[model samples]
Target: MTENMNDQLDASATFSIELTCPIGLENVLENELHELGLTNTRLGEAQVKLTCDLRGIYLACLWSRVATRVMLPLTHFNMDSADDLYQGVKSIEWSDHLSVHSTIAIDCHGTNKEIRNTQFGALKTKDAIADYFVEKSGQRPNVEKQQPDVRIAVRVKREKVTVSLDLSGDSLHKRGYRQQGGMAPLKENLAAGMLLRAGWSKNSQFSQLVDPMCGSGTFLVEAALISLNIAPGLRRQYWGFKGWKQHDHRLWQQLQDFAKNERVSVDDLTVTFQGTDREQKAIAAARENIKRAGLTGIVEVSLSAFQEHDFSWQGSTPLVIVNPPYGERLGDEMALISLYSQLGYWVTENALGGVCALLTSNDQLARQVPIRPEKHTRILNGGLECRFYLFPVVEGSIKRGDRQQAVMSQGAQMFANRLQKNVKKFKKWLAADKVSCYRVYDADMPEYAVAIDMYDDWAHVQEYQAPKSVDEEKARVRLMEIVTAIPSALNIPETNVVVKHRQRQSGKQQYEKVATSQHEMIVQEHGCDFIVNLKDYLDTGLFLDHRPVRKYIQDNANGVRFLNLFCYTASASVHAGQGGARSTLSVDMSNTYVDWARRNIELNEFSDRDHGVVRADCFEWLRKSTNEFDFIFMDPPTFSNSKKMSNVLDIQRDHVELIDLAMARLSDGGQLVFSNNYRRFVLDSELSERYVVKDITAQTLDPDFQRNNRIHQCWVFQKRG
Candidate 1:
């Protein structure tokens, strides 16, 4: 027989045969094939050209974990049109693959001139096969769309058509373990791919593996199975061999028995797999998936917040994998950034000697994490382009000393360089502007760096860095040195500049410096104290960028009832009340901040019953409040995932609804100032006819924050009566 006929005969009669490997990593797959003793194989793009009989197919399906799908080549032909496709497909010897009564499905994927549409190509191919069987045997197989006995895949690339029998039957990723779905559950195949990319192998020395944001336990289950050397396909009920005419029952049985007998017990291994989530429902889903994977005994699931959970790895370095909620699925970029920042802190502090891989699509938000990822890989998850950032946590005495030295070495120079750059930029910008009273500065340099403004002899500087711990005292001293140097650098008076610090508090004892300042804010603005507390929140009390908004409120607040939702420190309300609003109500949830708002109102001597500060949920208050206002300022938190609140408020998703709600509470021709720091806030077009909205971001932005519009987008919404 010829080479083709002999190969066909070998495939038809033999119980075992070897196959080729996939394209990009043919060498690696070749090594694996050699180890498996399968010598006869070919490699192609995304597919391994392999000649395998039924037994080889069975073994490949059960043992080969890296392959996406295993396909047995049925035929190869060239066709120019649908008619040619039908003629060529009908000529294939279908009897060897499927019987007249058996059901079959055609999955088509193609590129090039002949077969452009995959769906149409699949239909034509199916028609050809069905017509061939009917014309010869007077009977045809039924097409079962969902579960077919035999699945035929047609790939028509570059005018060449190759037909293959899908030996794996179903997608190999469906290892038949997962059942419950949670928020953004990791796909099993993608999870496997990630682990493989992370250099995880059956013999790798991974002591502990964890998925902190595990949704439905995909990674944990896969880790357990891999550690135990369990055949991924053993749990699956059906296989492609059952439908093939040449399937060898005895050989398939032997392969299955071998897989079963060779299965290694992970009990003796030092590896541990665990999953945790903040939601109890997600934890429950994870538990169910673990049990379904027969990994209940091996994998542990817990309902614990990732930021709070203590990761203990028994002195061995651990592998931490996390699929954090991207802002697309989870509302609010700001809240997600804060959460990621906290996650970074937790991982750096606790996972000493561990490695963490974070998957996220938001590059800007990812920068918020303090820990710098040493390696990054691009991957796609559910069509969302994402980057997998790998961070190696340093441990031991050497690591500690290195970290200290690194921080100390960069601390002073970073601050000094940023200060010098900002001073130079500010001077150049101020010289060009006509307004002598205005000031310009770089604020976000060094990420938490602050700069100052000195306009009309009033110095206003916003402190942007938050102190993490007592060790930041060194940074503070360096900041002071920069502050003292700023006057000389900018040719401004030293006595004129004032500083503000911003801090965020989880509770009373859990205070962290969010951002600090050397000389960013003036001691006073228009004779009013502009200094904001920076050591306690994400932002200081005063948003310097919204200076013009405050000015607008101050200019137009006479004889009006003002409502301020999400009134952090009530600076806007103070401006409105001081501008002689007939009545003002500042609504916020934070008692600390509401108290601060009250103090701000008191400072302006507007703290009357008319000028009220209500500490309650803004959504609840908005729904319940009957008081209509002539001027309303609705600037909700850009995004918050607070469990204490009724709903997670996302400005982008809920801006129109918020505007509608504020409009309901607005008097005829009332002015509503809606602001958000979401850099990409796109106003809904539907709101245009009912209200006139103007982009006031340029007008509102303070000179100090001119470099980066971190605080962005303020709009004046006037209801057209």
Candidate 2:
């Protein structure tokens, strides 16, 4: 058998081979096969087909890093039923490929109407092989699943079936280095693919490689092996060809010896590796994996967070790569935004003139990174779709500390000039009124459509949604320009700016918390104290546009019972309490806003007996209450379909009904104030005839909101005598 096998594997004999890999890795696998000297190649979905001799096949199994399996084709036929499948598999000369003494297993994939499923197909193929051996030699090979001596692969695509021998006994991703893996650990071949995509090579200019979130040290070990020219499968103990009639043992041994000789010594390696993880257990696992891969001294790991990790190693242009938690299996996504931001900041500060690559499954989290990646590719890791972002840093560019002095584009400089002028105009009023928060710009330039609000030293930049007619790439570039100009124009730190996309929101979206950072602070407006959170929600606790309306309520609140409806965070209620109102009642349906209102009341040191915050739908509460109040303020959302509400509220459609409900509980001599931010609201004509109505929209506009008169509309109503 051995002599015959050797003769069959001569220089003129070649076989058609197919290498299968994970989805999105076909191109990488093809490149690896090319490096292994397999020339006649064709690419398919998640696979590469090639023509190579037996020595070439053995060489690929030993050196192809990104291929999951190396398979040698045996036969191809059409099968419409189970019997056809059995006969097709049996028709292959089984004795030439396998002996009765060898143990075999069948790995099947796909199915058809007749095959039904993969398990049934595998079972039928196994029986066919067993019956063939029995009929030929009067004996059958035993079936082995775990450690099969000869593994046959049977794939059915509708009526078409292709059978091959899995030359790789086990998946090539099991590089034999990782005894255990951490949560959602990246497969070794996938890691190698990512490195290739990021342009990491032995002959590349990068002098060092680092993985800050190095779970089990997969990236570090793979990087070292690739740079050292060590064959990935050199340490693997078994192969499916071990018992095959055609496997040339002497030729395989010669290939292994040549691969061993090609490997570079640790001392001669040009690139260095470093890794760190916040979890001690992960560091421990990475240490074990590094040692197992024979890279104890060459690669090092320590217990530290990515931010505090020592990136000060002496080298030419270091490469920083990380696979941070994507918030899928670990924790809440809102909190992970800060983590990505910090990682981005670290890279911008430390990785000058090098490269930074990050792998994440969340798109929202990916945007939190301050710098925009030049290239991003879609890939899959452990069945979850992910994006691999690559950012190349040029020296003396993109350092966060130097962002203020960085050169700006022509349009961005114009935006900065306009912002500075607006700040200068507001300086006197802001100082005299002691207002710590106010809007500085409301899309003054048509090209740059964004609103800039200043809360002391911090800037809240909201970009209005661009029209569909506009190019998305152009809009994105303009928004980036606006954000980049704000910090330098306002003389504030870049980290103090938060950017959000703004569009028309319906239902409870306006009140929903988008992030868990909870970056809140207190600001004073007209001698009234209030708590404002700028990050968690769409609208901050205090609406700067309503400053004049709240002031009017406070001045007239003296010696009156004040009724505050739809009181979000109760900022107006706080002002009324400070104005010595006899008592104040605030109502809202959301529990989150209700709790926030109570905290604002407490912040003002108001007595609980005199100040009240109720969590109830204003419409329902008004219908149930018979009590009358002398002073009332109603501010309803433009549109809400909140589940807690008894009915959807559209201010434009339901304003008449809502006003009547509030008026039923209003005292005869009391003044009722109604306000809405809807730009196109028209009051009912019949209400003007029933009660005296006055439009106070013009009077309610403060200096900061004078440019946009339609920011809000206000009206006062009183019962006719």
Candidate 3:
């Protein structure tokens, strides 16, 4: 072409370059480019355009922690149709960048009228490039989608296209130190941007860094690299420039050597990094990543919960950066309120004069931290809109009074006394039966209406919905007192106490999940082990009141084919399996409960072909199955109109048909146990006349349910002799 064009194609010559990052990080990327001595920069949406030489581009790729890709723009043209795109792409001198033998790939973005989809645009661009090479040298390079020799990036906006040569083949987030990350891991570049936003520097006043909820040590590793002046891209093995014709291999090697020499050892660094995570897998992953990053002893990580971890340091104020789990599903956010509150309390009480930066997607959860953020910035992570809050940790700044202890009223004290008395009463029975999961108190006192249940070391408190005659503020205050009294009365930490408002449920609302924390543990009840989650759902997987019913099934389940219909979590089925039932089948409509049942069965070492779980309507399954069961148990919901069901179910109205279906599946001497929580339910007289029906409600009531005798009604049905 021209002499000026030849100079522009040279590796040492200056040209216009663009550095792209996540959308909200434009300003951060600009400042980073300035730090790299490329000052002639203009900011665009998600990109920073600048004029720099090839060495400057290499430096940007090596050191720019926030930028996702470093691109060198070749040309821009207006497009009216697909032919115009083809012509514009073909006009470029392709030989200067790569030869026909090299493999190539195209990544197109921002479709126009001529290109309605990204795939079509990428295909058209590939055709143009292939045609250009074919016409020039009578041969065309092959297309490689995974790892191409040379990668071209094309962006179209408002019928205008910009073609650039991508220098960073993979996204800059792959720092090569992390082999795996925990669920919903933060991107490495985003972590670096967050660190920079929190004002973390090598010579800053902060001498220590702490992350209480550190998942896989992203923030700690990024912060250590930044403090030691280590280049982020040094560990990466591949780049797009390696296949380009004009790539300067000698110059790139020199840059790498310089970066290696410039990095300081962790011993010379002043800041000490510490991290703690509640999950063992997370801690293991973090340790492996830290070892990979060559900071094994320099950065320390431990397996500890957020509420129990110690965040103290011996020197100046520490900067705490936390990227806690923000809950991806609908009900997940409800369980994180206490977690955020604990975080805020720790930062304010323990880290005075320090700074804290928190990242979360839920605004309500963020506001629960009891600290007013000095700055709040909106950012996008993994396509979820999130906010990064920067708080200057100071004393008495938020004015949240006395979070350490709740002022208990006289009513609360009475409730606490009742709780103590109930525990004392159940102490002998619980120990004798080896039952760790049981109801301690069931609203014995009218003024403080709450039911307290203990599962191992944790306490689950559910408040009954107050009447309309009760004042709202008074009810709220009473709830606060109840929550505060529960931990002290039960001798458990406040973090182990889970609180939920109990209300009358209809249809599928009772089965709906209230939280997504999935914090589960194994608890022993009646010599059987079952999984229970106090924080995630309205009811723990194990039904405490059904201890007697499960005991009956376990006592009578020898050598019989057992059937458990409407088995929520299949706890009864587990008991039957342990009772030596020849074969067992558990059926439930909800997929979540079915999966939970599978886990329960597996936990009890009953995951064989004999014990099966089916996710289907119990009514439908009973009608379809031809196999007979010798022992059957059916405990349907009081009322349900689930869309998945063929017909609505009302316990009082449909008990005859349900009982008949279960009886049809029973063998000659098989006995069917029927139960429901409908307090006002009455059995049909005609069915009682047709079959031998006997009320077994008294036998099913355990000591824990004796105080509330009407909690459930039970009956046993069998054929006449």
Top TM-score: which candidate number?
3
For model 1, how does the per-residue alpha-carbon lDDT over 63-111 read when each residue is reduced to its tens digit? 7655667776666767777777777777777886679988998999876
Cα lDDT for residue 406, candidate 1: 23
Q: Supply candidate 1's per-residue lDDT for 9.
A: 43
Order of candidate numbers by lDDT, starting with the best: 3, 2, 1
Each candidate structure's count of clashing pairs? 33, 0, 0
TM-score of 1: 0.58
- Residue 26 miss distance in model 2 (angstroms): 7.1
Judge candidate 1 at residue 561 and give its lDDT.
93
TM-score per prediction, in order, is 0.58, 0.72, 0.74
lDDT of 3 by residue, 560-596 (tens): 9999999999999999998999989999998879998
Q: Rank the candidates by TM-score, best first.
A: 3, 2, 1
The model with the greater lDDT, 1 or 3, is 3
Give the C-alpha miss distance for residue 432 in model 1, angstroms.
36
Task: Give lDDT per model, in order.
Answer: 0.68, 0.84, 0.84
Residue 569 of candidate 1: its Cα lDDT? 79
